[model samples]
Each structure stands twice: as structure tokens, then as C-alpha cells.
Target: IKDFLIKNKITFIEDETNNNEKFTRNRIRKNIIPVLNASIAGGLGKFKRFFENTDSVLMLFDFLIEDRLNIMKSKNPIILDISKILYYNNKLRKNLLYYILSKNLFVDSSLIESIDRVISSKRPNIIFKEKGMIIEKSYNDLKIEREAGDEFDKEDFLKPGMETLFNGYTLKITKTVFIESLLKKKNVFVFPLSAGRRFKIRTLQTSDSFVPFGMNKEKKVSRFLMDNKISLSERRRVPLILNEKDEILAVGSLRRTGLYRMKKQKGCLCIYVGKN
Candidate 1:
């Protein structure tokens, strides 16, 4: 390449660091590799061929892994169906695990091994946390979640406007005349304005209980969440809307109090939970 460049009058600047013996690459090229080439039969050529073959195998492995991942497609938490990969050989399984986890965490061989063990165990619910990331196995689904930036209890006053809450959710509190419009939306909850605009948003509590929108009997907030299939990590981030007396008016985007549901046309407050 250098001879061809010189013959063609193609000017190029060389990095002097390439020749510096203090660097590991330079030391290997200057000292160790020449000795190996002289003592062994086609040592450098054999090493080059080994790497080329390894690269080709890896390319094929990547293609196969990508096809499998597309079939197991899921949302934000990167859920994988255990059944899909349960029958795979060890090498392919580990490769797929590394691919899925490498996006958010530094996936080493040991980490991959640990994940493999979890899969083999077949525990209904198993959680492994490392470096601010959580990998949870629940029945057939393996979920990967990043720990929230601020996992502490997030609370705010629900005023008559828009505000941000836990996990970048938009909490919009406004008075709307069209009761039918707000009724159609799942995240939007309506309450009588005469009930007084004194709602506040806070994290869940163990003893929290509320009468769900359609139910006459009161239910435990924790039980409600479990029934609704809310994960343990997600329960912490769910905002509980309350009045001045600390009565639970709503449980995040899940449920609201039936005691407060109003059908009045004129004056009603709309509390909308929206994603950014």
C-alpha cells in the first residue's frame, strides 16, 4: 500500500505513534511477532487465517440470532419468551442473551452465564440486579429494565394545569365542559369540581386501599396492582392521587374511586395521565 501510494504521488501523513515501542501494539509488531514468524512455520499467516474464520462464523451467528430476536419481539423492557430459546444449544443461547443485554449493560461471559442459570432454574419470579439494571424472570417472560434515574418517592401537588411526574408521565389537571370526551379516554379521570380541587400525587403505601371505579367494595391498592399485572418495580413508580384527607382518589393510570365519579355536564375536573 505504501509503495503504491508513493508511485501514484498520493500524499498521506503517517501517525508516528504507530512506531512507538512503548505502545502494546508497536511492541508486539516490533519484537514478539517477528520472533514467532522466524521460529514457527507460517505462524503469522496461520493466526490471520484463524481470525478470518472466526469472523465468518460470528457473522453467521449474528444473522441467526437476529432472526430469532425478531420473532420474540416485545416492548420497552425487552421481554423474551423463554420457550423460544429454551431448546437452543448453549452457545446460541448465550450469544442471544449477550445481544439483548449488551444494549443497556456491559455483558461479560460471567453475566451471560448467570442469566443462563436463571433461565434453567425456571423459577416463576427471579430478580437479578447489577450496575443499576434489573433482569427479572417471570414464568415464560424474561424482562430487562433499567433502574429509574431517581427511584425515590416522587410526590407533587395536582394543580389546575400540566405537570410532570414519575417516569416522565405528563399529569394534566384541567376543567372540561365536555364530560363525554374525557370519558372516552382511559387515562383521563373526571371528578366533580364541587369536590374541591385539592388532589395531590404521591407514591403508593402498603396500607393504601380504595374503592375502584366500578366496584362497591373497597380493595387494597397492592392487590389491585397485582390483579392488574403491574410488576413490582413498576408499583413504586405508580402515582397515587389523593385528596386533602389522604383518601385515595386514583391509582396511577390503573383505577379511580367510584365514589367520586361524576356525570355532571357543566363543571368537572379532568385529570389526565399521559406519556411524554
Candidate 2:
């Protein structure tokens, strides 16, 4: 087949169906017997003609299925939440479930049953479908937030010239000591120390309340960005500071409440500011 395609300058995709016993069992259980019955009733002949007329459509479906399967394998194993079954019609839901089973994707049958029960009782939830996956909405008020930053590389939270005060003694910048200091603060400033690299800063003038990590968050910057789908380049910038207590004093828009005061007390204030 490969040689024929190459010699004729023809492009064709080959689907190799496994002939192993395990796959045979699956075919028998899911498709073969049903198809045989339909064939006796002339349904299979109609289906064959339909597929012949829709060759391009079938090709597209095959490509989509292959792409989705590749993605599923590359990522973690398929996982589904049962909460979404209510959103799809019965036929679609069953087809989706059958696809997962045919692909050998792991799913909690109990969860699917539970979801059906909930829907039967007049409750419906969000639905998500991807690859051999299906999930139901589990939480009603869940909020999702996103941030743009360099992938965490070597924890560059503390850089040169940042000061830290420990037990009344001011300590100079050292990698070990810097990391130790950050462990104490609930919120710490993080910035890449390499020169010319830009660190994102949020300012009062341009920032909005959207808390990415707190219980009930507030941040206007995030809200504005989301409302307009703002790109990262247009976001506001802020200052990055390291404190005498080995903490991130201020992220950019807001000062760590006592960071400036501690810097003055130590008389060894060294600031390393990055541009982005």
C-alpha cells in the first residue's frame, strides 16, 4: 500500500483494525452482531451506500477521532465527571459512553449512574466532552482564573540586592536564605531577576479586583482583562520588591504593608527592578 501510494503520487490513509482476540471480543459485543442483524433487514446496505456517498465526511470524522485520541494519550489518562449526562439527549449520551468504552478509557460507571439519577430527579449540571472523556458539572459557583507568566524556572523569587532581617540582624542576599524568608509570607512577590526581562505588574490606575488564589477574591485588573479578552502585552505593570524579612514586600501595585518601613530601618535597602 505504501509503495503503491508513493508510485502513483496518491495519498491514502490506512486504518489498521486489530485482529487480536481482545479486539474481536469488543467488535462482537459492541458492533458486529448488531450490524449483522441490521444487514438482514437491509439497514446495513443503506448504511454502506450512505458511507460511500459521504466518503469525505467519514474521512473528516476519522481524522478528528484520531487527533482526539492522540491528545488523550499524550495528556493524562481520560477522566470523566458524571454530572454532565443530563445535558445531552439519550442517543448522544449513549454514543459518547460507548465510544469511551470502545476506546478502553477508564470511567466510573457508578458516577454515570449517579449523574443519571440526579437528572432523573430533576437536577442538571454542566457538561464537558473531550476525546474519550465526559464530565458533569460538580460545583455551581466555581470560578476559573488564568495568569500569564514565564513557566516557573528555578524559583527566582529572590534576586540580588534583596534584603532580609532575621532575629534583628540584617542578612545579605543568598539563594538559600532568600527562599527560606519567602516561606513565612502568605503572599510573596516573585520576579525573574535577569536584566531586561519584563515582570507583569498590576497598578491601581489600571487594575481591577479579581482574586486568583483567595477564598472571596477581588481584583479589577483580572475582571477587565477577562471582560475584553485583553492580551498580556496590554496589561498594567507593577514594581517587584524583596523585603528585609526575606518576604516579597510588594508585588507591583500594592506595597507589602510594612516592607518600606523595614527597608528604612535596616539601612541596607537594595532594590532589583526588572523591566517587563
**Least accurate 10 contiguous residues by lDDT in model 1:** 62-71
Candidate 1, 166-245: lDDT as tens digits: 55566767765655667888798888876446667788788999999889899999999999999998888888888777
TM-score of each: 0.44, 0.19
Runs of candidate 2 with Cα error greater than 4 angstroms are 1-75, 79-87, 106-137, 140-276
Best by TM-score: 1
lDDT of 2 by residue, 167-217 (tens): 122223322123434434433433223211211222324433433322243
- Give the Å error, residue 180, model 1: 1.9
Worst 10 residues of 2 by lDDT: 140-149
Best by lDDT: 1
| Candidate 1 global TM-score | 0.44
